[model samples]
Target: MSHYPVHTMATAPEASQPSLHALQSAFGFIPNIAGAMATSPVLSSSLVGLFGNVHGGSFTEPQIQVLLLTNAVTNEAEWAVAFHTTLALQQGLTPADVDAIRSARLPNDPAFAALSRLARTLIEKRGRLDVTDSAAFLQAGFTEEDLLEVIAVTAASTITNYTANVTKPPLEPAFRDHAWHPA
Candidate 1:
């Protein structure tokens, strides 16, 4: 982390500035994840681009949060787990569901359970989802489009998850209340 050079908008490379500033505006601060990510402008920009694509995809905000939280927990990314925990609640997920995901359990709700299971499987299987995995997601009422969108969300989360692990960014204060550790 000392070697990673956590950057501010002012200190970040020009390629990274827009992404950093956007994250700052979205969360009202540049998360340490983005700061450390700024150390490599190309990678940072790639994350921002992937983020935009995922957010613009077919999933609703709540679904997106579910995917993110699932990825965070699956990957054991403490920083992302904390950040996505807050976001998941804000997106109208119940505390119980969030807790279930945080604890590495499936949510009680059927659809969300399907989503969490699908996301976890996608990651655990390294995106080589078998037909049964996709079938289960479809059985839960998700569309083929939704299935593809899940891949986008997974990719986006993978960027954040990997970046946080590598940079070991300290959690931002606002998200610390929901801080998590992989069980």
Candidate 2:
């Protein structure tokens, strides 16, 4: 069950938008976390924009998915983990791939593993990257520009994960099977 009551898109249409309705129609239900976002259309749109900026910018889909899952695990945010894991798999990642990313390992590709490690480190260390860290990532084929963009993406998702936790957004029925209440 949700920690708080999530206003559905119907009665609380003011809390949502036409896009939100489209989301509901497309996915069969608006995710409770996303529904909580409906309370502030500006926030919802900004969140969507941030997602688009990060997910659609710089990184490949698999890499972005892994980074999202990594952030959730590092923050111990269950909902973020559940939501992104579902989305990644739906986008064609295997269970093993998800597991690898969650563990900060990438069995299939070393470059991705390097990226995931660097991302997790950046998150855990809170932006104080060491010279050695930078060197290792460089050897792994990442440029300074790539690192900067990755930092931006990481920062954006971190905000969303923390916000969702604070709001205790309802986990959609579609995600019930994967919903986790982090202790």
Candidate 3:
């Protein structure tokens, strides 16, 4: 059983309502992970603020999904894996790219593969990137700022990953088709 209560917008704390509503607006529903996070107004609002910054960062929408999906996969966060798989395809990633991420492999596209590699490395190394690691990401055409932004997106995904692990939210039906498990 889930340790956390999955709050609806109506039942969620007042301070968490806007964040829940924004997630609902963006995704057409309040994800269970967010609902559980809503149990803490601070955690919910902080996630929303961090997500806004991550989305505002220096990458394209599809590229951002690459980073997010990679982090989710690396962290073995099943909920986020399903969610980001859908988002990546919706954002115009090739089906193959999503499949690669679903399989915990680099995306087939060279640029996105580079992104996936860097994201996985960040999590695996706990942000202690070797110089060669950062250089390879830059050599793949991402800027220095983009590397920091990768860290931003990683932070955002890590929150969801940790939340899902703790709360054990059920995956939404809409994302069921894309559900994943880390190999």
RMSD of 3: 1.1
| lDDT values for all models | 0.90, 0.72, 0.90
Cand. 3 TM to true fold: 0.96
Q: For candidate 2, what is the TM-score?
A: 0.79
Off by over 4 Å in 1: none
Question: Which scores better on TM-score, 2 or 3?
Answer: 3
In the range 93-128, model 1's lDDT, one tens digit per residue, is 999999999998998888899999999999999889
* TM-score versus the correct structure, for each prediction: 0.95, 0.79, 0.96
Model 3 clashing residue pairs (backbone): none
| Clashes in predicted model 2 | 0
* TM-score ranking from best candidate downward: 3, 1, 2
Runs in model 2 deviating more than 4 A are: 1-4, 11-29, 104-108, 176-183
In model 1, the Cα lDDT at residue 183 comes to 63
Clashing pairs in 2: none
The list of candidate 3 runs beyond 4 A from truth reads none
Order of candidates by lDDT, top first? 3, 1, 2
lDDT for each residue of candidate 3 in 89-159, tens digit (9 for 90 to 100): 99999998898887878888999999999999999999999999999999999899888888889889999
